[model samples]
Target: MPNTRWTIVTGASSGIGAEIARQFSAIGHNLVLVARRREKMEALAAELTAADRGFVEIVELDLAEPDAPAKLHAQVTQMGLGVHTLVNNAGFGLRGEFVDLGLEEQVTMIELNVTALTRLSRLFLPDLIKRGQGGILNVSSLAAFQAGPHMAVYHATKAYVLSLSEALHEEAKPFGVTVTALCPGATESEFGARAGMEGSRLFSRARMDAARVAKIGVEAYRAGHAVSTPGTRNKLVKALGRVLPRSVMRKAAGEMVG
Candidate 1:
């Protein structure tokens, strides 16, 4: 039987997003997986189906495109899938000085990380409020809590996500909807290589597993927590940012990225 409600996970082809989909499916939530790679999503769908996890739907899309959000919503509606959860996980980061990075790439990053996330949240929020019980899980980063010198735009985007999610959490309380920001530190994933941060000190240090991080994030969403940082070390790092001076934090961040 088809699940009555669906959890939509963007960037579902790999990394944390992929793990989140698996965990959600394991918990018997029907899924709508969206990503730019159709073949990858199709493979995931097949695996989930073979396991009889739940009904899995794949929507291959590049959400960075201006019309993608509306088109995605339309596809879900057309498929008669009522969205019970939205995971805005489709974003990437670039490790470079802001001025040295390609202008087009930075703009596209903003489009994906900030614009797409905000648009999807707004597009789905009305329905979630009407249902009065759904949730939004935004995958931010530990970078959200501090300023990053080399990856300035990426850090800013995550900060936006953290801020937006917290405010939405408060606003949605009366409606019984939960909004959570999952802030994970450097994890074992493709992110480092893709972002050109593979050789950075941060990635060289200890990292958490994507599956573990995803499990923690999913559990936090289920518990209606406003923000969740997976590893104990990550939590401590985030806490330390509170007492550290802005100059010190910036210097530390710059050194890590270097």
Candidate 2:
């Protein structure tokens, strides 16, 4: 049994999730790095262990599976590991009109983004309550604030995450559980490529850096903030979404993402 406080970071094989795991490692937190790519996670564990003298457990998982959370809970329980933090960062995007994208892709997105996140949070909340202190960081997106035409389903999933995280923040306050929604803008990663936007100049022009995004997410969660938008531009976009009419916001988002 691992007796130390454990921070579980999903999608930790690469990109933002990897950076988040790295940040947690720097602070001496033992990790359970979850991803579908076992080799990548093992490599990350090796690097973090060597560099920071930190401990990391690699779990090759596909969060899109409905039974993943339950399996994860059982594994952690069997190991007698105490989870102090959970970062729900395993999600992807599909870039196309709703009618143009295949139904399976959208379903997979929902499975990973909404169902997996909700289940993990619910599964871990009780333990955190018993311990009287813990944190949950949900990785949403700046698109969560508005309706995106090209990324409708993905944006909608993130909106659910943001709303759910905000509500959880309030509900968990008395229980000493902090919930934070990390709303990052277009990040410099292979996400755009995977989403079929590899040639997008707009994506390339965006200012988000994965490391900075991870830092902001961890800092916000530690500070007990309910929401964290990494970049100033993203912050402004959030504010605008709040102030603008829903129709106008939707149109603007469509233009930007389309």
Candidate 3:
């Protein structure tokens, strides 16, 4: 068993998740990358190991399962791996009218984006608190600032994440632990394709590189920021949303995805 303290990054096979993993590895952290694709994670593990980023562990499991968090906790404990950070980035978005989308798919999004994240945070957070360091970085979205009509549940999940991370940040401050919500606007990622959002007006504009998004997120997490929204454009959008009428933001958000 590796005695090194590890950073566990979920949804780490590619895109922003993979970029975040690379950033952590470059900074001298061993990693435990969790995702559904074993082959992709293995390839990534090889890359990180060859680069001398310390040991890499790949756990191929669907975290959407209700029991997966317990299994992950047991596995980490069995390996005697001290966790330094948790990155909850494994989630997908669906775009469509609520009534038109498949109910099961929407529910699955909730399971992955909301339930799994909450469970994993609950499972590993106490250890970080007890140790008086490290933190959890949750992947939120600019949509979190306002309602997204076509992607209603997705926006709601991110809003929950941002809220949860901010509250947790306050609770962990005395313990010297941070809880940061990394909110990025549309970036180049497989998630965009999977969510069928790549061609939307929001994504059609110049998108931030996945690497840059991760870099900013890592910096914010290190700085112990409770909320970090990457990109000047995204920051402006969020600021505007704060003052805009909800009905107007709703219309704009809904139109962006159309």
Candidate 4:
């Protein structure tokens, strides 16, 4: 009964994660949607199933919990779902002076953004390697390119994601397992409000649609690309971040999110 072709997408209840699920389903891939929001995931499952895109299995769980990765893997095993693709997209951001943010919240952010992602990857990567035709798409951010002063922890976490993904891309390549890092700039999603960044200058400019970004990411993964930063503007911005002075970059980032 193992659904050996299932794609496991974390944070699949909303935003980029939800869009990614939609795209994957459209391509005939059955999905295991993981998120804390059961109702939302159930709704999405109904829609996807109604469209006859693919089968959808909603798994409501908080990835931020320390044991979530193990629990998730066990659940998948129980369901006989072979995870052919793992999308580590369950993460969040916080905007404010590092010192002003609640220590507990920031730590939880790290737990989800970095710890949970690593745990899940470690848990699922072996199977993907054995399959030799699967992929891992990690959702990093444009912030990964440089230091983000006001959103230091969030930026750092994304940087970790980008670094890990790129390195894994090379290591997994010989096994025919593709790893890709998706870096998106400002996006129109609940992320801005949740992160307290809605009024920031970063969102003052036009933001990319989550659906478009998701499509680009999924396509890049399928193409075996190591990294994909959607949007021409975002690509240019990341390119500039590469050569810009550290001080200048830091100041600009601070101002944009401060």
**Candidate 4 steric clashes:** 0
Off by over 4 Å in 4: 1-4
lDDT of 2 by residue, 127-159 (tens): 898898987999999988888888899989999
Candidate 2 deviation (Cα RMSD): 1.6
Go through the candidates in order and give each one's C-alpha lDDT: 0.94, 0.89, 0.93, 0.93
Q: Per-residue CA lDDT of candidate 3, range 15-42, in tens?
A: 9999999999999889999999999999
Q: Pick the candidate with the highest lDDT.
A: 1
Q: What stretches of model 1 exceed 4 Å from their correct place?
A: none
- Rank candidates by lDDT, best first: 1, 3, 4, 2
lDDT of 1 by residue, 1-258 (tens): 556878999999999999999999999899999999999999999999999887999898999999999999988988877899999999999999999999999999999999999999999999999999888999999999999999999999999999999999999979999999999999998899989999999999999999999999999999999999999989998888999898998899989997
Query: For candidate 4, lDDT tens digit of each residue in 1-258?
Result: 523478999999899999999999888889999999999999999999999776889888989999999999999988887788999999999999899999999999999999999999999998889989898999999999889998999999999999999999999999999999999999988899999998999998899999999999999999999999999998998878889898888888899999
What pairs collide in candidate 2?
Answer: none
TM-score of each: 0.98, 0.96, 0.98, 0.98
Q: Which is superior by TM-score, 2 or 4?
A: 4
| Preferred candidate (lDDT higher): 2 or 4 | 4
Pitting candidate 3 against candidate 4, the one with the higher lDDT is 3
Clashes of each: 0, 0, 0, 0
Model 3 clash pairs? none
lDDT of prediction 2: 0.89
